[model samples]
Target: MDRSANLVSFEKIRKAAALIKGAVLETPCLPAPRLSQLTGADVFVKYENMQVTGAFKERGALVKLDSLGDDEKKRGVIAVSAGNHAQGVAYHAGRLGIPATIVMPVLTPFVKISATRGYGAEVVLAGNTLAEAKAEADRLAEENNLVWVHPYDDVHVIHGQGTVAMEMLAAQPDLDVLVVPIGGGGLIAGMVTAAKAINPNVEVIGVETTLYPGMWGAFYGKEVRCEGATIAEGIAVRDIGEITTEVVKKAVDDVLLVSESSIERAINAYLTLQRTIAEGAGAAGLAALLTDPDRFAGKRVGLVLCGGNIDPRLLSKIVVRELARDGKLVSIRIDTPDRPGTLGEIATVIGDMQGNVVDVEHHRLFLNVPAKGATLDVSFEAFDRPHGERIVAALRDRGFVVRYLEIGDRMD
Candidate 1:
């Protein structure tokens, strides 16, 4: 395949489909009715989250490894990744009985590193950022005579990733728009190749985090730096892939960026509305969809939920932040007389307002209140913002001074 044209042609994608059969999951494309309602579009979600190892990278890793000659395989493999790619290479290499060494940055999430090691691959924790880690991997691969696998640059990897578009179009042939996340551009470039082959009319849009616009810079031939922290860590490539840069430039319609807040909210929304768990990168496609719902309105659009290997601690934080966003959780303090019935009075007002009290504490020593007065801190889950306001109104109406606690300076 003369890939200089930057196309992973239908023929190549089909071959990849056959090559990776039984090696990876044929992740399902499901109807996203809730997302459709939110966007006024016929939305379908490609659940790559269900892929083996809980991500789509397995497809590319397996395909790439499968292409290696016996000597290359004997020499083993080395790769640099934040998480998903590391696990993909480790799992597939272990399955092939090929020794694997994965180099990941120190800041890489513990869950990802653990999962990669659990796949029977040696993990080297080196460097502080992905770029630094990748440099270390290159040096080690040279030293060990191992075949270094470029996560997004290799043709076999791109071919494997192309299968996603094949599945999407097969599951829903009339899909008018295909929204995919753009990190190093392996996924989107491959998707664009297969999608354009199947249906030229289908608009293939690449979604990216505002923090890292690698693909965007490549598409426009601009020297933009990809920096800043983003929730979509899966696609936080500081540099775009060389091969994928060409592919995306030729095939992708336009690259779109979404704020970290939007990405976080999309992750939460997918859990709440679609009943699906999406890692930061997995949620970027849907984030773009939500950002410009009207652009896809009334059309059949497909978005890929690319991965779901989020850490438990991060998940807990997202849940709490979402609850705060919905106005369901609130904190407040009240000045009350030091009498025991004063606590009962506030509790009665909250109970009467049908708010579920989550916690309450009385402070007498740290407040500016008189010796006869106390400060009561209360936490509750209200039905909505109005319900929370109503409870505050009820307290004020009863002559008890009440003030809502500030939940930090989070704008969203």
Candidate 2:
């Protein structure tokens, strides 16, 4: 496993850039003023999420597909991906008249599975994790004589992914740091290869979800437990590619692991502060900055927003959760007499304080609550934490026992 020998060179990445030119978008790399303010860094974002398939995967998939011989193209290609890579291969293969089949994990979101199928690839749902799905893809490829289009391991794929950094540095050559998210390591490996080649002084940092610190563990030689449900499911990889590991070990400046909560906050920041949608993995770079702002403060940092194909329902939940965390949405419990006017009185106090009640639940049969009294659980919208606190104070002034409910607290 002499990975140095297999390292994707700058020349190959240049070729990939040439091959993908006109076929794929050279997405914008622009200064993010609000993000800069938040992180205390001169933040520039590469909008890879603006690609036709809503991810940077299109770059690598197209380059890989173009490298296939005519006979191989006719034989079709098979790939295993949670979502983004599947759509990339499926969409490009459709354009090239190459039949495509995608094997996806059973837990992949319905939105992604549907999008992949919509791209004209025959979709097969198999296995519970990506590793399991890859096994099924291997079997299918063997039986059907399909060419395997690996999601990240191949040299061609790595070279194509490198174009992201090439373009980023071309647009802003003075970037002090380039923060990239790692799944199987193709993206960062490629980016680091190009970034370091272009300007060795520019540090390339890799970010991974704490739950799946595959690249982090490989870089540090630590046995990390890489299993969990993370919002950044795209990078929830348990294994690192051999070539990527070698490149990261040799070239990458640092590998950082970010918590799931930080990832969620980054996603929200992208939406609220930058007016863009960033999926969990796409926001990992920003999460790294949020997790440790001082490290990047006052430096020119480039962050790759790699993908934006988040499920609508999940995005809505993230938005609501952020509002709750900011105290714009508040939940409270009140113990009061079960009399007819009790509920109206409480509602009046909230209304008088300009709090907009959204949901209310009444429980009278609880063993803890007296038989003649009931508990009112109310969720409301306020302008800010101070406003919510004011509303709570108003309730208490009226002699109602009110308790603010924290997020994830069990009402029981």
Candidate 3:
């Protein structure tokens, strides 16, 4: 499909910026010293996760809602999303006294589904993927005379999303490039227009998870595989928006792909260094920087942490997995005589070595263990990798058969 550039302009974006002034939070675009250290670039991070709905989707959703005719508002609005966009539309629609219906995938996260409904939008769980949910949403909109508020494809949505760039440049005028995550391309498309319009020399780059490289594939005019269980599900879009693709091609300087592990590292970095929570898609920009540090070294690169809607369970898993990978957390199985004093003696050794045991499992009756021996699997927290090694060495000096277990090996 040939996409037309110039479908959105700076003036419309400025108007959107004005319209959403008091309605949306003017999210901070501040220097990230820790991220700068990690990425080897002078990095600034935009905290769009600070928005009430914990996403940048609020800006676009509000603008689209405000643009609706009174009759349309009376008739209501409908949207399809399983994440931030659903919350954004539901939140603003409730505030504006418009009836809203959100169609989400059946497997949508419980937190998201409840949050959208709490904002007073009726949630219909239909289909299995976002594409299928959208089909249901489209049908409902046409059947009920409801305005269809598209998550990323609409002009108003793009204009509103551009407001982030306006605020970024206003706060820090000398940014060399913007590193934004691309899903259906609304955020980057809007950002590219505003950034280029303000300063033609400023570069805009889009980041996509390697699992779903829709925009990346579009740029190269080849079909790339687009399906996987990505942690960055927010940007796991298989299709690029028509209007957004046009602006992206013209204004975006580059589109890069980051691997799943890179994204996981970025999320862990955000939590540890920045003391902030970033959803997988939100951390993609930083993931790209981690993947290729020299590409952005010495440049004032801006990263948009787009959302913070990750589940607590998932966040804990990511954090613990990172700790295990870093050797701060470890699991070890020790072959021990099935004597009463054996558990106490090993636990004492670990404590004396400064290893704090968090969990333990004893397998005395397992086929792998000798009749008079038990396999004790213990999980411990160490100060660091070397400290963990010291603890292991201390246990080994005691003549106990010990083996370290990787996270994957320990998972049941």
Q: What lDDT does each candidate get?
A: 0.87, 0.93, 0.91
Q: Cα RMSD (Å) between model 2 and the true structure?
A: 1.3
Question: Who is ahead in TM-score, 1 or 3?
Answer: 3
Could you estimate the TM-score for every candidate?
0.94, 0.97, 0.97
Candidate 3 residue-wise lDDT, 1-412, digit = tens: 4444455888999999999999899999999999999889999999999999999999999999999998999999999886899999999998999999999988777778888989999999998778888888888888998899988989899999999999999998999999999999999989989999899999899999999998998887768988878898889887779999888877789999999999999999999999999999999999999999999999999999999888888899999999998999989989888999888898999999879999888887777688988888999999999999999999999999999997756423
Separately for all candidates shown, the number of backbone clashes (residues 3 or more apart, or on different chains) is 0, 0, 0
Question: What is candidate 1's CA lDDT for residue 150?
Answer: 77
Lowest summed-lDDT stretch of 10 residues in model 1? 403-412
| Candidate 3 residue runs with Cα over 4 Å from true position | 1-5, 408-412
Task: Tally clashes: model 2.
Answer: 0
lDDT of 2 by residue, 129-185 (tens): 899998899999999999988888888999999999999999999999999999999
Model 1: pairs clashing at backbone N, Cα or C within 3 Å: none
| Lowest summed lDDT window (length 10), candidate 3 | 1-10
Q: Native-vs-model 2 lDDT? A: 0.93
Q: lDDT, candidate 2, residue 107? A: 93
